[model samples]
Target: MNGLSPSRRRARELVEPQHWVSGATESVAGLCQFVLLLRLGATLMLVVAAVLIEPDPRTLLLGTLVAGTVTAAELAVLVRHPVAVVRWPVFVLVELVAGAAIAGLMEGGPVFFSFSCGSAAVFGVAAGLRAWPVWVVQTVAAYAVVAWIIRADDVPATLAVYLTGVPTLYVLVGLASATARAAVIRHVNLARSALEAIERSAVAAERTRVARELHDSVEKTLRGLSFAATSLPQAVQQRPQLAAELARTVAEGARTAADEARELLGMLRADDLDASLAQAIERACQEWAVRTGLRADTDLADVEAALPVRHEVLRIVREALGNVARHSGAAHAWIDLVREGSTLRLTIRDDGHGFTVPGDLNHLSAAGHYGVVGMAERARQIGGRLRVFSGDDLGAVGGTQVVLWAPAGAMAPMSDRVRT
Candidate 1:
C-alpha cells in the first residue's frame, strides 16, 4: 500500500472494507440491519429445531447454549449498534468461534448446517468485501469443523459433499453483498454531485441577471439624473427659466431612478417568470404605451421559452421600450413577436428620429448607451443575436429597429406554454 502511487493509494483508501460501514449511506445501513434480522430469526428457529430433534440430551443442551449465547450477543451488540460488530476485531472472532462450535456440537445436522451458512452470510455482509481475509478465516474454520464431524460421526457420502460445498457460499454471498454496497454508494455520490452543480449554475445565472437588471434600469436612470443635476448650476445664474426646467428634470429623474430600483427589487422577490412569454410581452407593451402616451401596436405569435430565456427577453423588450420613451421623439411604436422556423424573432420599431447604428453594439456602454449594450448582452446570453437598424444605413425611413433572433434550443416546447 505504501509503495503505490498517490492516485492508486487514494483509490485503495476509498474501497477499504471498514469504510463500507463507517461511511454507510442510509440505504446501506438499512441493508445491514435487515440482514442481521434475518440471521437472528434463522438462528432462533434452527436452535429450537436442534433441541427437539437431538436424541442425546447433553449434546442438545450444549448446542442450544452456544446458539443462544451468540444470538444474545448479536442482539445486544450487532442489533443496537451494527457498526460495532464490524469495527471491533473481538466481535469478528466471536462470530467465527460461534459458527465452529455450532457446527461441531450439532454434528453437521441439516438444520444446524443451514444455520452455520446463514452465519457466514451475515458476517460477510457486515464485514464488507475489503475484509476478505476475515471471510477466508471463517470459511476455513467451517470446513475444518465439518471435516471433524464427518470423520467422528459416520456421516453419509452425500451429506459429506453437501457439508464441504456449503462453506463456499460464505465467499459468494460476501462478494455479492460487498459489490452491491459499492455500486449503491457510487450512484448516490454521483446524484449528490449533479444536484450541487445545478445549484451552482442557478446561483451564477441569478448573479448575472441582477447585474443586467442594474445596468438596464436603475443605472440608466441615475445617469440621466446625474446629467440633469450637473447642468442645473450653470442655468441658475444665466437663465432662471432654463434653471427651473433643469431642476424639475433632476427631481423627476431622482424619483424615476428610485422607482426603477424598487421595481427591480420587487421583481427579484416575485416568481413572475412562470407567465406566458407572448402574453407578458404584449402586456408590457400596453403598459408602456399608457405610461408614455405613445401609440404602441403589438403583433405577437404564440410562443414559449425556458424561464431564463423568457427573463432575458422581457428585460430586452423593456429596455428597448424605455429607449423609445426617452430618446425616440416618436409618436408611435410597433412591436412584433413571431417564430421563423427554428428561431424566435422579436422586433421593436419606433417612428422617432433615428441615431446611427454603431459598428460594434458592445461599445454602446462606453458611449453611455447602457440600455442598448444590455439588450445586446441579453440576446447573446439566450443563444441569440441582436441587430440594430437605424437611419438610411439599413433602409429605415426615420426610426430605430431593434431585432433579436433566438435559436430554438433556448426555447421550450409549444406544449409547455403557460397561460397568464
Candidate 2:
C-alpha cells in the first residue's frame, strides 16, 4: 500500500502541465490529444457507415479513399504541431476546409449528413475550449454549410437536424470544454499567487534577520567605541592609571566587535540552506546542549518545506533555545517538529524559571529582547504564528513553551497575527 501510494502520485504528476508541457508551444497538448482521439473515432465511424450504405460502392470507395488520405495527412500534422491549430483564424479555416471536403464527397446520404454534424460538433467544442471567439466563428460557418447541404435533399428533415442535433451537441460539448479549461486556468493562477506570496514572506524574514544580526554585533560594538573615545580625554587629565585602563578597554572592545562582525558575516554565508529542516534543528539542538550543559530531547518528524521557510523555522528554534540557555536556567529542554495535515507545528519547551510574556510582541523590542521579537518576525515571514506560553500563571512547574505553526507548503501569505 505504501509503495503503491508513491507510484500513484508519480502517475498523477506525469499529466500536470508543469511536468508534461513546460513550454507555451505545448501548452494545449493534453487538450489536443483528447480532441484528436475524438475526431479520429468520429471520422472512422462516418467513413465506415458511408461505405456500407452507398448504392455505387466502387465510386463511393474511391471518393472515401481520397478523403481518408487527406484527413490522415491533416490529422498527422494536427497531432505533431497542435499549437498551430489553436490559433483562432487557423483553427476555423482548417476545420471548415476539411469538413467541406468530407461533406462534399458524399453529398446527399444520411451518413454524410450525420458526419457533417459530428465534424461541426467536434470543431466547435475544441474551439470553445481553446478560445470562445473561435467557437462563435466556427458555429456561424458550420450553420451556413448545413443550410446549403439540406436545401438539395429533404428540406424539413435537414432543417430539423440543423435546428435540433447540431446546435444541441455543439453547445453541450462546448460548455463542458470551456468549464474544464477555466478550472485548469484558475488552479494554475492560484498556484502562481501562492508561490509569489511565499517569496515575499521569505524576503521580509531575511531582512529582519540581517537587521537583527547587525544591531547585535556591529551596532553594539560601535556604540561602545563612541562612548570610550568620548571619555578618553577626561580619563587622561584626571588620572594616568584610569587613562591606561580606559585605553586597554577601548582596544579590547574594538577587537571584540570586529571579531563579532566577522562571525556574523560567516554565519550569513553558511551553506545550511541545502540541509533538511529536521537535520538542521537536530544539529542546532546538539550544539545548544553541548554549550549550555542542558539536555535536549528532540522529536523531529520528516516534513517537506521550502528553503526560506526552513531557514526561518531553524532560526526560531535557535532563538527559543538561546532564551532557554541565557534566561530560563533550565536543566532540560524539549523540541518537537511534526507535520499536522496542512500545517507544520514546532514546539520547544524548557523546565526553567519562566518569565511573563507580554500581550504585545512589540513590547519585547522596546525591552531590548530582540531574540523574542526576531522569532516572531521569522514566524510572520513564513505565514506562520508564534505563541509564547509561560510564567507563574501556568499550571505546570516553572517552564516556558514556544510554539510556531506554519503552512505545510510554506506558500501562504504573511500572517496578520504576527506583530511587526
Candidate 3:
C-alpha cells in the first residue's frame, strides 16, 4: 500500500524473488516446457489449417508469414528472458495487435479465426496468475477489432465462444497450478530448515556428553598414571618396595584407562547416571593416594541430589583430585561434602603450591589447562556455581580450594538461581 501496488510487487517477486525464484524456476521447469511445446504444436496446426483453406491465397499467404514471424519473435523473447516471462503482457499485447491486423487482412475466414483461437490459448497460459487480465483484454480487443472489420453477423457464434471460453479456463488453471506449486515449495523449505536445526542440536548434545564422559573416566586414570610415572624413579633409589608399588599402580591405571575408553565408546547411546557422588569421590581419592603417596582426608555428610547433579558432582570431584595428583603436587588433599538447609556444598582443598587465581576463568583454556574450565561447565550444567581460590587467598601457606554450591533440588531452573 505504501509503495508499488500489490499486483506489481507480486509480478516482480515472481520474476526474481530471493531464493524463491530460483527454486520456483526449477519446480515449474517441466510444466513450462510442456506448455511451450503445446503452444508451438498449436501454432503448427493453425499454419496447416491456413494453407489448407483457399479463399484469397495472397492475403492468406501474407497472414501466414506474419503469424509465423510473430510466433518466432515471442518464442525468442521467452527463451532469452525466462525471468521476464511474468511480464508477458507487454510482448503479448504486441503479438495480439499484429495477430488482429493479420486477421483483418484475411477477411472473416476460417484460417484467421483458427489462428487467433490457438494464439489466445498460448497467451492465456503464459500470462499465468499475475497478468491474466492483460491476456483477457488483449484477446477481447483483438476479437472486437476483427469482428468490427468483418462485421459481427458474418463471424460465426462458435468462433466467439471458442475465443473466450478456452483462454479463460486455461488462464484460471495456470493461476491455480502456479499458486499450489509455490505453497508446496515453501512447505519443503520449512521442513528442511527444521531437520537441519534438529541435526545440529543432536550433534551439540553428543559433544557435551562425550566431554563429560572423558572427564569422569579416562582423564582420572591418566592423571593417576602420570603421578605414578613421575614418582617411580625417586622411590626406586630410596625405597625399592615403594618403586615396585608405583610400577604396579601405573600398569593398573593404564588398564583402567583402556577399559574406561571402551566403555565410553558404547556410552554414546546411554544417559544413565548411576554413580554415587560420595563413594565415587572416596574411590578417586584412594586411587590418587596410591599413585602419588599422598594423604586424602574425606569428610562426607549425607546429601540428596538428582541423578544428573550427582553424576556431575562425582565428575567434578574426580577432576579436582586428578588436578591435585598432576598439577598441584599437593602432599595432602581434603574433600568435604556437606548439606546446609536447602543447599549442598562440596569443597576440595589441596595443601600444595598454588598458582595465582585468574579473574577470567576462560584464560584456563587459553593456557592449555581445561580441568578447571571443564569443572565449571559441569557445575553450570547442574545449575550450580564453582569457585576456585588459590595463592594469597589461602593465607601465608598457599594452597588451592575449589568449592561447588548447588541447590538440593538439582532440577530447579538455572534462571531461578542468583548469578554472581
Candidate 4:
C-alpha cells in the first residue's frame, strides 16, 4: 500500500513498464525500480541513523550491509514465486528481528529500528496477503518492539523518541501503502471498462458487416431464382409451342442445386462481397431488357460511391424491377439513380397498368415475397424511406413508382476510402 504514493501509484497505473515487446513478459524495468527503491530505503536509513542519532560507525555499516542482503534475498524470493505470490513471513520476520536487534545494539533511538520494520513490512505484503490480520500483525509487531525498547528505562532517550520520530514515520508509511492498494483497484476497474467498450464496438461492427453481406450475396441469389420462377411460368403460358423448352429450363434448376446450395452456405458464413455494384447493376439492366424485351435504362453513377448503400440500393432496384416484370403489364421501366442535394435518390417507374398497393406486400406476392419486403426494410435501415406511388391518375398506362432516397453523406464511403 505504501507503493500508492501519488507519483508511485500513478506510475503503476500509467507507466508500469511493459516488457512484452521483443518477446519478454518479464518486468525488467519494474524489477529495477523495485530493487532501486529497496536499496534507496536501506541507504536512507543508514544515513539518517548515522547523522541524526550518532550511532557507532560499525553498527551503521552493519545495518546497511544486512538490509542490503535482505533486499537481495527478497528479490530472489520474487524470482522463485513469480506469479504464485506468497505471504513472505520469512522476510517480515527477518526485518522485525534484525531491525530490533540493531536498535538494541546501537545504544541509541528506538525510532530507527521502527522505521526499518515498517518499511520492510510494507514491501513484504506486496508478495500478496492483503488480509487485515496480516496487516494488523505487521503493524503490531513493529509497534510493540519499538514501544517496548523505549518503555525500558535502560535504553535512554526522550519519550519523543518513540512518539514523534519512529511511530510517526511508520504511520505515514502505512497510510501510503493503503493509498497504493486503492490505486491498483481503480486502475483495474478502468482497464476493465475500456476493454469491455472495445469488445462491444467490435461485436456491433461485425454484426452490421455480416448483415450487409447477407443482403448482398445470398439475398441477390434468392431474388434471381424468384425471377426465374416468374419468367419460366410466363414463357410457358405465352408460347405453347415452347412449353417443353420452358419446362427444361425449370428442370435445370435441379441440376444446379448442389453447386447453388454450397455457394449460398459459403455466402452465409464467409463475408466476401467481391462482386462490384457496377457489375451487378449492369447485369440487372441487361438481363431484364434481354428477357422481357422491355426498354430498361439504368442511370448508375460511380457504383462504389456508397459501398454500404450499394447493398440496399441494388436490392431495391432489383426488387422493384422484378415486381414490375411480374404483376404490372409494363413494356418499359426506368431505373434512375441521382444525387439530389444531400440525398441520393433512386426512382423505378414502369409504364404498366399499376394497381393499388395491397395492405400487405407479403399477402399479394407470397410465392416470391421476400424481395419487396426486404427492400422496404433495407431502405428504412439506411435512413431512407421507400414510397410506392401508384393510384390511378399518373399516365395512360398507370404503373407502380418506387422512390428511395438515401443520404449521400451517411452512406459508408467507397472501400478505398475506409481505412482498416
Candidate 5:
C-alpha cells in the first residue's frame, strides 16, 4: 500500500494538524531555504553543462534564461515569504512546472534530471506528505519528457538509464526529505514541551516561596496581633495598664506586618535576580553592610550555577546575613563562596556572641525563631544542606558560622526534590 508509513502516521497522531502546519512553516523555513539554495546551485551547474555541450547558441541561451528565471522566482518566494511556500500548494505546482520546463529544455539531460530530483526533495520538505500526488505527477512528467527526447533524437545507450532510474531516484529523494522534515519537527515539538514543563515547575516553586515568606513574616505577625486584640477587651474591663500595653503591642505588630508585606512585594518585583550569581551575592552583601553599618568582607569565586540554585543560595545568604544583623550582634562579617569538586560551598561567619544551636534545627520553628529554620528549608529545597556552628558548638569562642553546601548542577525545581 502507498499510504502513510507507520512513523508518519504516529507523528500525525501525536501532532495536531494546526501544529503541523505551523511547525512546518516556522521550524522548517531555514531548511527549506537551504534546500532551495542547493537546487539553485545544481541548476547553475546544469546550465553551465548545457552551454558547453549544446551545439545551437539560441537554444543554449533560451534554456539558460529559462532556468535562471525559474531559480530567481523560487528564491524570491522562499526569501520574501517562506510561509507561503510551505502553506500554499501553488508553490509546489510551480516548482513542478519549473522542473519540467528546465528538464525539457535541456532534452532530458542527466544533470537536468538531477536538478529535477532536487525539485522533488524541495517539494517533499515544503509540502510534506500531503503533496505526494504532485510528486507522482512530476515523476511521470519526467519519464514522459525523457522518453520523448530519446525517441526524437538518436538514442544513446546511456539515455536509456534516465527512463527507469530518474523516476526511482525522485521517489527516494522525496521520501527521504519528507522523513527528515518530520524528524526535525518532532524534535522541535519535544523541546518546546520540555520548556513548558520547566516553566510550570518554576511557577510552582515561586508559589511555594511566596507561601513560605508569608508564613514566616506577615502571617505570624498578623496571628500575634489577632491574639493581642482578642485579649485587649477583657483586659480593659479588669486592668487598665495591661489594656494599654496590649493596645501598643497590637499597633506595633500591625505596622510590622505591613512593612514585611511591602518588602515581600518589593522582592518579588525585583529584577536583580537575573544578574550573575557573583554579582547578586556581592550586591546583597554590600546592601546589607550599608543598611546595618556593619563591616562586611566577601571572598567570592567566579562560578556559574543554574537559576534555581542561584536563587536559593542568594536567599539563604540574605537570611544568614539578616540573622547576623538582628541576633548575632556582630560588628564584622565575612562571606565566602567557593566550589569544592562538584559541590558549591557558601560560608557566612560573624564574630559576635552566639547562642546555643538546637540539636534539631526544626525545633527552632516551635520557638518562633524561623530564620534558621527557613534557611535550612531553602537549602534542602535546592538539594543542599546547611550547618550552623555557634559559639557553644565551636569551643568557648563567641562567634557564629553558617555554611551551605549544594550541588553545582542544581537545575531541578523544588517540586521535584524530596522534602523532609
Candidate 6:
C-alpha cells in the first residue's frame, strides 16, 4: 500500500476510490447538468456584480441586457435536445466568444476569466453529443480560443496561468468524450444482439410446436396402418369366412398414406440408454423357476431408465425374453441396467438351456421378431452396439446376457441424470 491511507488517497483523486470508473462516468453526466445550470445562475451574478462595480449607468445597463440575453439562450439549450445536436461544436465556439466578450466588458476587469464557466459547458456538450466531427471542431476551436486569449490581453503572469496550462483540461475533455461515445456504442450493440437472440428462440419454438402437431396427426395414422397390416394374417387364420374384411385393410392403408404425405410437408418446412451389468450369474434363478414351475424372483430395475429411447426398446426386451421363453425353456428373467462411464450397459440374462448365438442377423426378421430387428437398428442409429452371449460348454457364465453398449451423446447425459 502507499504511505497514505486508502481513504485519504481516494479523496485526493477528486472521485472516490471504489467503483471509480463507473462513479466518474455518472459524475460526468451530473456535472454537465450542474455546470449548465451554474452558468445560467453565474451569469445573473456577473450582471449584478458589473452593475455594482461600474460607475457609468449606460455601461451597466448594456452589460446587464447582454448577460440576460445569453442566459436565456443557454437555458433553452439546457432544457431541449436540439435538431442541431450535431452543430454543438459551432455553438460551443459561439458561447466561448460570448463569454470572453462578457468578461472583457466587466468593470471588475476579469478579461478571459468567464471562459472557465462556459468552457465546462462546451466540454459537456462534446461528451453528450454522438455526432462525429463535432468534438474535433470543438477541440480545435478551444485551442484557438486559448491562443487568442493569451495574445489578446496584457495581464500579470500568475493571472495569465491558464494560457499555458489549460491543455490539461482539453486532454481530460477529449478522454471523457471518447469514453462516453464508446459506452453508448456498446449499449446499442448489446441491445441489437439481445433482440436477434430472442427472435431466433421464438422461431425455433414455433417450429417444434408445428412438428409435434404433425407427428400426432400423421404418425398415429401410419402406426394404425402398420398394426392393421400385421393383423391381416391372424384375422384370416381365424375368420376365413369373412373375405370382405380384407378390402377394409386396403382403405385403411390408403388413408394412412395420405395422412403421412401431408405430415412430410410439415417436417420439410422447419429446420432447426441402458444400463449395465449386474449380478451376472444370479439371474439364472429366475430362469430356473420358470422352467421348473417354481416361483420366479425378478428384482429388475430397468423399466423407467430406458423409456426415453422410446417404444422400440421396450419391444426389444420383450422379444429377447420371449425367445428364451419359447425355446430356451428359461425359468426366471432379470433385467439389469448399469452405467459404465459415458455408456449405458443393459444386460438381460436368463438361466436357461443356453443356445448358440444366432448366426443370421435376418433370422430374427424371418421369425417375425421385428421387435429385435427394430431395436438393433435403433441402437445402431443412436451410436450403440448390441451382442448376445450363450452356450454352456464354451462360456464361463452359463446363461445368456444380451449386453447393449450405447454412446450416449451429449444430450443423453443430462436426460439420463434426470431420469435416474
Give the top-scoring candidate (TM-score): 5
- Where in model 4 is the C-alpha error above 4 Å? 1-39, 42-45, 48-56, 79-82, 86-165, 233-420
lDDT of each: 0.72, 0.66, 0.67, 0.57, 0.76, 0.51
- For residue 342, give model 4's deviation from the true position in Å: 19
Give all TM-scores, in the order shown: 0.54, 0.50, 0.40, 0.45, 0.76, 0.34
Lowest summed lDDT window (length 10), candidate 3: 411-420
Flag clash pairs in model 5. none
Clashes of each: 0, 0, 0, 5, 0, 13
Task: Estimate the TM-score for candidate 1.
Answer: 0.54
Instruction: Give the per-residue lDDT of model 4 (tens digit) for 123-239.
Output: 433432333444455556556655665666555556646443554444455455545544554455576678879899867865785766565546555565566667776677787
Tens digits of lDDT, candidate 2, 325-346? 8789899999988777789999
- lDDT value, candidate 5, whole model: 0.76
Candidate 4 overall lDDT versus native = 0.57
The lowest-lDDT stretch of 10 consecutive residues in candidate 4 is 18-27
lDDT of 5 at 31: 73
Q: Candidate 6: deviation at residue 75, Å?
A: 7.1
Best by lDDT: 5
Candidate 1, residues 62-137: lDDT per residue as tens digits? 6656766676666566556544533434546676677667666666564455555555555555555655887687
Worst ten in a row by lDDT for model 2:
411-420
For TM-score, candidate 3 versus 5, the one ahead is 5
The TM-score of candidate 6 is 0.34
